[model samples]
Target: MPKVRIVDIEDRRFRVFSSPTVPGGREFVLVHGIGISHRLFSRLHRVLSAKHTVHTLDLPGFGGMPRPDSDPDIADMARDLAEVLERLGIGPVVAVGDSMGTQWVVELGAQRPDLVTHVVAIGPVADARHRTLFAQAAALGLDSLREPPSANARVLVEYARCGPRWYGRQVRHMIDYPLEQRAAELVPPLLVMRGGRDPIAGPEWSRAVARCAPRSRFVEVPGQPHLVQHTAPRPVAEAIEWFLAEVPQ
Candidate 1:
């Protein structure tokens, strides 16, 4: 896992993780949620890395990197990701995102359709029905109750490392991102997935995302929680693989 430094136009350096690409194999890029880095997707990455080229990106300010002088919104972060992939010469890869990371991928797909072949959003955030901060917090709390102790412990550590002040700022951007509206503009295929037991991203919200998009699908990983990628990597990976094979041309 080599760390690739991506310097944005503002000269902010973002360290991203990259895996070696296999000849004639599918390409995948995994984006993690706010307050956590690529570490959360370690299990999922390993499962996919066996057969596909997987790149795990750690946006600036997360995963031990220095925070930018100013916070960047979802669109800005999406452009940074596109620039990084462009510099690396990677093209039209499947982008998988978790939680708030989903918003970034949606923005990326809408902004750079040429760079992304498809997008998979797992446990996406800011459900329209529960748009308020308090409602989102309540849903997260409910999901936390369903998640395993180990998963909760990991999140606690990651959140502490992220620091309350910085994490709060990022959450504001996340909750404010208009995911459904942006989803409508995505040219690439979109797949919105939610864990059966995930309260953060319910079935209704996931389906709404699919409905808004021109080419999209919605799936559910049963008996999984908010951290399905960590707890149910096989199922999540299988779903993504199936979607990739069925993506519209």
Candidate 2:
């Protein structure tokens, strides 16, 4: 089994997951959304790690990495992640992201084209119009974190990985960054997947993105929400596999 490697850049350190596969076949560097750790894809990682080298990193200000000193934008994070991929000798590898993470992958495609091969945006949040709605909805969902109809304490701990300050800065950055332009810069053959019930980046936004990236395709997983990767890992992985399978080696 390929274990996690901790990479230190200057004063910051990030976590990465490597696969058992030698030669790192079809590397997938997964950048998680705001305030989340690579563990979010624990199930998918365990499965994919068996084949391609699956590298998942903790963005600064989220997970085990130290909080970023400034209100960093997605581009900055993408560039930083690009360096990580380079150090791992992982590209032109496929880049997979969800929500905020997905947006970052778009930025990566725009700024560091050489690093990303196929792009997978799952439950992508391409703008503020959708984010404000989702944030409000997440706040409301937090209110019901009790039992039966509420989220558990453990998930709450996972949610806290973003930390109040980090999460706040992320929301601020998301508002300032112009994602529509970035979404349009995709290099083509982009795979966009959104959960049917994901309020943050619903079907409408997914379709919009598909239209924006003329070479893109969209898929909606039924009964899933913004965390489609978690709610339905198998299908998400399958979608990615299908997309990568078609990519010219």
- TM-score against truth, every candidate: 0.94, 0.87
Q: lDDT tens string, model 2, 134-195?
A: 66557336323322222234345656866777787786666566666777877745888987
Q: What lDDT score goes with residue 215 in model 1?
A: 93
Number of the predicted model whose TM-score against the real structure is largest = 1
lDDT (Cα atoms) of all candidates against the true structure: 0.86, 0.71
List the candidate 1 regions with Cα displacement exceeding 4 Å: 1-11
Q: Residue 12 of model 1: what lDDT?
A: 54
What C-alpha RMSD separates each model from the true structure? 1.6, 3.1
Among residues 3 or more apart in sequence or in different chains, the pairs in candidate 2 whose N, CA or C atoms overlap within 3 Å are none
Clashes per candidate, residues 3 or more apart or on different chains: 0, 0
Candidate 1: TM-score? Answer: 0.94
Instruction: Show where candidate 2 strays beyond 4 Å.
Output: 22-24, 126-128, 131-155, 246-249
